[model samples]
Target chain A: MPEAFLILILFQLVGSALQTVLHLPVPGPVIGMFLLAAALLWKRSRTRTDKPASSFDSPALSSLSRSLIACLGLLFVPAGVGLVTQMPVLLANGLPIAVALFGSTLLGLMVTAFVMHKATRDRPSPERIPDTGGQVL
Target chain B: MQSLSHTLHQIYARFLPEPNMETLFWLSVTLAVFALGVRLQIRLGRAPWANPVLFAIAFVALGLLITETPYGTYFQSVKIINFLLGPATVALAIPLADSIRLVTRSLPAMTLALLAGSITSVVSGVLLVLLLGGSHDVALSMAPKAVTTPIAIAITTQIGGIPALTAAFAILGGIIAAMIGETTLRRLGITDWRAHGLAAGIAGSGIAAAQVAQRDPVGAAFAALGIGLNGLVTAIIVPLILYFLPG
Candidate 1:
């Protein structure tokens, strides 16, 4: 578990280094997420014939990541508590903030769902999709 | 009585010094409250309003108020948990990698949905704030509220918004979506779990994604993809929009 955590932190550090070097707008951990995903996919491609032996594909890493993400909500408490200091701003603009957040979230959800449904609604099932078989490789 | 009071005060001061004891005390309090919240949420059948994060924050804030502890002190003590967010975020790769096949299968539709959803989330949010007479800072903070909290905070900082305000807005937005997301999607006659989960992830983020995961694994995968992709897209587009439009 510790080793898995170290691997995740190592990816995050590399991502931070990349962000600093390239001045990317995205955060380091996000970059780390993309890098790690890409690396996993790449590893899977190379070891398609047999069970992969790489540590990145280890069940330990998988379980560790799952547990961390399961508790992702608890991770936000500290920052969410920071809202206490913004009470004045929140109180002052409570109406606009509330409406905008609620309305826009609802709208975004609808639009995304609508588009995704429209695009895929008419398509045949997964078995018939041409890209389903070997697109990743 | 006076001597006894003085002796108790001295004992309290000696045993619970300012820095070390305070850290342990606040950390314990935060974890305990959150654990209680998780149990309550489970008991409540994982209702949206009983969201553990929301519960923990409200309780902890009240605790801080009653104890006369500043937000800064509580945050400083629990900063270790916040630090783990980075690694947890990086850990998202595991699920994303696991769902790569599903993602690749519907790449075009997913991309289209992601783009439409991401753009709408930013434009609609910022425009609504401005039109509703909110200040520029408030509008900026609302811009990334649809993204997950960590990425939302980073984007808010980049765009000169209040990160704290953005975090609160993002979490609230998530709760709101989780509350209404399913009914809304169902009313729209969208039965596809993939669409449902993607919508949850894009607009509702982790909070909503967790909700989706409760019902369907396939939808959950798409939801994870939604969170990651929306974060990436919004991170790029919001800055670009600000740069080109200067709003």
Candidate 2:
């Protein structure tokens, strides 16, 4: 568990380094996510011919990630707890914010779904889409 | 019972002399409350809107209020939880990696959909807020309402919005999506599980993804994809979008 966590934190550190050096607008954790994904892809490809290979595919990493994400709801509670202090602000601007949030969320959901459905109409199911495995090799 | 209370008060008073020890108290309180909230959610059959986070927040907030503990004090003690957000955010890549094949295969279509969805979320949110006479900060915060709370909070910070408010709005978005996202998609004739999950996950983030997970694994996978990609895209583009907006 500790090792898996270290890997994640290391990825985050690298991401933060890139963000700080490049002055990117994106968050470090997001860049870290991309980096981690890239690393996993690289590992998966390298170990494809080998039998039961690559630590990237290890159950520890997968389980650790799952547990971390499972508790993700709880992780956000501290910030949500801060909401008590903002009740006044929420109450004051509640009407407008509510309208905007409700309207935009609905619109975004509808348009995104429509676009994806249209785009994938002629394609295979998303689950069956094959990986671009050999392209990098 | 009286002796139990006396012992608890004694233990609390022992920590009173040390500032650092108070961290333990608050952390314990948070975890205990949050765990109970989760148990309640489970017992309630995990209703879409019976959000555990909402319950925990309300519990902690009310606990602080009734005990007359300041928000800052409670937050300082539970800062450890906040720090975990970074690792949690990084962990999001796990699901993304799992779905990377699907994403790579449908890269163009998915990219287009995400870009359109992300831009629509920010633009419509900002415009609505401005049109409704909300402050500039509110507009900026609301712009990232389509993504998850962590990413949304970060985007809000970068775009000069209030992070706390942005977090609240993100949760609100999730609850709303959990309630009506599937129904709305069905009404629109979008029966595809992937499309339904993507819409809900994109608009509502992790909470909506969890809700989708309860019904269908494929839909949940798509929702997870939506959460990761929408968060990444929104984080990258929201600042630029906000910069160009009139607000």
Candidate number of the best TM-score: 1
Stretches of candidate 1 above 4 Å error? Answer: A121-137, B1-15
**RMSD for each of the candidates:** 5.5, 5.5
Error of 1 at A61 (Å): 0.7
The model with the greatest lDDT is 1
Per-residue error for B118 in candidate 2, Å, reads 0.7
lDDT of 2 by residue, B147-184 (tens): 88878888788878888888888888888888888899
Candidate 2 is graded, for docking, as acceptable
Off by over 4 Å in 2: A123-137, B1-17
Native contact fraction (fnat) of model 2: 0.65
Q: What residue pairs are clashing in model 2?
A: none
What's the distance in Å from true for residue A22, model 2?
0.6
lDDT of 1 by residue, B141-245 (tens): 998899989889988998899988998998999999889999999998887889988999999999888777776666778899999999999999998776654
